[model samples]
Target: MTNTETQVPLARFGISAVEIARVVAVFYARVRSHEVLGPVFAAHVADWPEHEDKIARFWRNAILREKSYSGNPMREHVSRPDVKAEHFPLWLGLFHDVLRTELPERTALQWGALADRIGEGFRTGIVAMRQPKDQPPKLF
Candidate 1:
């Protein structure tokens, strides 16, 4: 079978809390070592312990559909003037890598698509907030 044909289906595997934890742990490990994004993330997330828990919970809600993680991710980053539109793609790539490492291929793509949509939405919203009301929304 071709590689694509052998890929697992999203419905075949259920998302669990353990999977969420694994994704968070692996993703942060990469983030901490990432050349382009490490300093940016470190400068913003001063309290690693608290940040880790919040990230875990956010992934849990996103993957498992448990309690809604209603935190405004855009608001969290709005104050960080260094964060720009280019950063979103790097973040999405890292997130996709984490999902692929922790989940099946199909599941990874599914999660990646969701992350892309969310990241685009958040990025657009953040840029919009930065713009004057008279200006049109910036396209990502």
Candidate 2:
């Protein structure tokens, strides 16, 4: 066989669409109730159900390869002035808790790792977006 491969799809993690729905639902429920994140999200999201559905679509595309998601997540997050870098850790902690509660141990662990990476990306991107272009980027 050529050096080609097929390891990119997250579907190999055995995540189901139903689980994705449940996790997104639970995680956002917590987010809305969170003291630090609730107000930030409430400022922009008028329709909770619609926002949850769209997020579910994103996870479905990421985990199930449905390719149904079409939104720019980084743009969405970075454009919001209230979405501070401090919120990502809280968001991810809630997410990991939901994952651990909703999925099997190994699956939750793998999904948590993926979420960690995604959260880091969001945090760094938001930080850079807020940084001045003329000044040197903060090393930390």
Q: Name the TM-score of candidate 1.
A: 0.81
The prediction achieving the highest TM-score against the true structure is 2
lDDT of 1 by residue, 10-55 (tens): 3323677777777887888899899988988988888877788898
User: Candidate 1: what lDDT?
Assistant: 0.79
Worst 10 residues of 1 by lDDT: 7-16
CA lDDT, every model vs. true structure: 0.79, 0.88
Candidate 1 regions exceeding 4 Å error are 1-13, 68-70
Candidate 2 positional error at 126, Å? 0.7
